[model samples]
Target: MKNVEPKVPLAVAGSSGFLPGCEGMRGAAALGVLLTHVAFQTGSVTESFWGRVWGRFDLAVALFFALSGFLLWRQHARAARGLSASPSTGRYLRHRIVRIMPAYIVVVCAVLLLLHEARGASATVWWANLTLMQVFVPYSLVEGLTQMWSLSVELAFYLLLPLFGWGLWRLRGEAARWRVPVIVTIAVLSLAWKYIPVPTADGVHHDNWLPGYLSWFAAGMILAEFATAPPPRMVRLARIPMLMPIVAVCAIGIAASPLAGPPGLVDLEPLEYAVKILCGAVMGYALLAPIVLAEPGRHHRILASPTALMLGRWSYALFLWHVAVLMVTFPILGVPQFSGYMFPVLVLTVVLSVAVASVSYALVEEPARRALLRWETARAERYRRQNGNAETATAATVTKASA
Candidate 1:
């Protein structure tokens, strides 16, 4: 992996240019999550077939994981190939923190301040979220935002990424050839762990844990591997125009069918549950393949459209605050469950979320991220200058001694 340039552009491909299609895909995923929560909140479509389809939007998390795996590995592999310097742990962590934290902290504090009466004023709950450890404790998991649990799961991946990349880096030749299968096997094991049925506090399940979703991440890693060193066969497969949409539609159908969602929830038997997980992972890959693999600007127009790009840019903030939007919208609009008002409420919720997210992205996330990056860059430059001067001084002393 280190010896060559990636034959194809990986997801979002670094600063040289953004993958507009991938951005659109991410925006769609965020919308899907928002719709899923809306469906859950209003008893509007829980029993209908289409309602079940909307509910299965929980699959968006799988997409999120895959994107993370693909993009992060691409960055790491690029560094390994000497396209860029390897980031120190602190610097890497700082980058991740600045990207996610400023907006997240603002949302957390805002939610607490606005909804203190509805949500308990527990200092521990505040601390848990501030540290991104909400998944460990039960109450904090759903305290400010139920969806934030996934963010915590993502944090676990962030911590594990460096070591995971190192392990993959150590393999050579035949062992490297086995990378995809090994990651797939691990993914299978992750799903299998959910079925073990360990005792837990009521309503708390293994779904919140990092292990349950490790396979989704692994699936993304597989895509990264193929993207970086495009096997001829895989590249050909990706180029097939109708392949991705067909697979994606089929995957969604399977998920929405009675087999996966009779009650607008994933309440299948153990074997069926495994099938659902596998299908969800497959769906994620199918949806992402074209976005990542298509010739730049040659893919679906909708994904690369201006609106999609704008939404995608704000997708992170959207994900963070969509639930809060719903919380506020329901009361402000006086939306009723299982009524015609639900659609308007949904529309209004999306609008409010997007508006708030746009402001937050511009005012908080973008500014903070840029400032932190600039600081890191300036620090590196200073260190380089000091080292260069020291080297010059040492060389002059050596020359004097020789003379």
Candidate 2:
């Protein structure tokens, strides 16, 4: 079969041409998550209109999942389309582990050791949180680390992605046409998983698991597929001025309404949960589509700016630390939980979280990533040299036999 080059847009093609706006979106998503947590803690989520809007900012988690799906799956998509070689599963897993675990483990340890409520936690609790397995066990979520369920779900997806990529790699000829449809079916089934009867147990929250949110990730994966070889319809849609942003805003507005269910800790009905899931997927996709599809422009430039890039670079650490910072802020400021100081608490938390996150990124995350990448490079070079020598010896033997 002839290898066909995918017609990827220049804005999102090679490494140098990757979308800068995605960095901005990541920064924005991190801020959204922090803001929502602050609103909930300050009792603003239940008190005011803006608070409700802030509450819906948990949609940022969907955005994070979507971004992960797109960015991580792109290589697989390219490989499926014959644009590039498939990524090595070992190297991919190594990169994913190094990218997330160093800073994550540091924050998990710090939170468990430092937080008053976590001081008396059992070893099981420590093990669960450290391994990002808190969501699997009932009652394992520590106070300051309650937000890590999403991270656990993310880790699950990371472990599962290589298998999914292998499946994609198996598509050949006409079978490749089913790729998008198959992914869409999986997304639908994942959403339907929410309706399956699972009895509630002490501290068990089924919604926190990966199944409930796979659709959001699938949305990004679908976009990744589209980006690799955009269909005529997608190209047309991307060219439509302001279409995606408008859809994103409208989805958000609907999500903010009662239709998507009450904010905070209230249990939602099945229908409400489905609505929230659909809205989140739509909103996240809408927000990200333009960045992936459109040509470079003012919006991209703004998002690609130095400040936004820095925020994006620090976004993961910021996410890991914000909830902990928010938890400590109430005590340090002498404000009671749910006491009405939303603005002040938000300000303080943002300031402290950013400071801590910057240090974590600089001293922990970046260094670990660089060190592992260097190791991977060295390992690859050694493998190449060994393979080269083996090939040379085999050729010599063949020549001698022919003589």
Worst 10 residues of 2 by lDDT: 8-17
Tell me the TM-score of each prediction against the true structure: 0.89, 0.92
Instruction: Give the poorly placed runs of model 1, Cα more than 4 Å off.
Output: 1-17, 77-88, 172-175, 261-269, 296-299, 337-340
Q: Report RMSD for candidate 2.
A: 4.1
Put down candidate 2 lDDT per residue, 1-403, tens digits, no spaces: 9999996544433222467788888999999999999999888887356877989988999999999999998888877878778888988988899999999999888888888867888898989988999987879988788889999999999999998987777773456667888888898888776688877678887887888998999989988887877765775686588999899889888888888888776778777888888889998888888778775443576777899998999999999999999999998899998887999999999999999999999999989988997998898899999999999999999999999
The global C-alpha lDDT for each of the candidates, from Candidate 1 onward, is: 0.76, 0.85
RMSD of each: 4.6, 4.1
Error of 2 at 22 (Å): 0.7
Residue pairs with backbone overlap in model 2: none
Task: Flag regions of model 2 displaced more than 4 Å.
Answer: 1-17, 172-174, 296-299, 391-403
For residues 6-49, write the lDDT of model 1, one tens digit per residue: 67543322222357777888899899889888877777556677
Poorest 10 consecutive residues by lDDT, candidate 1:
8-17
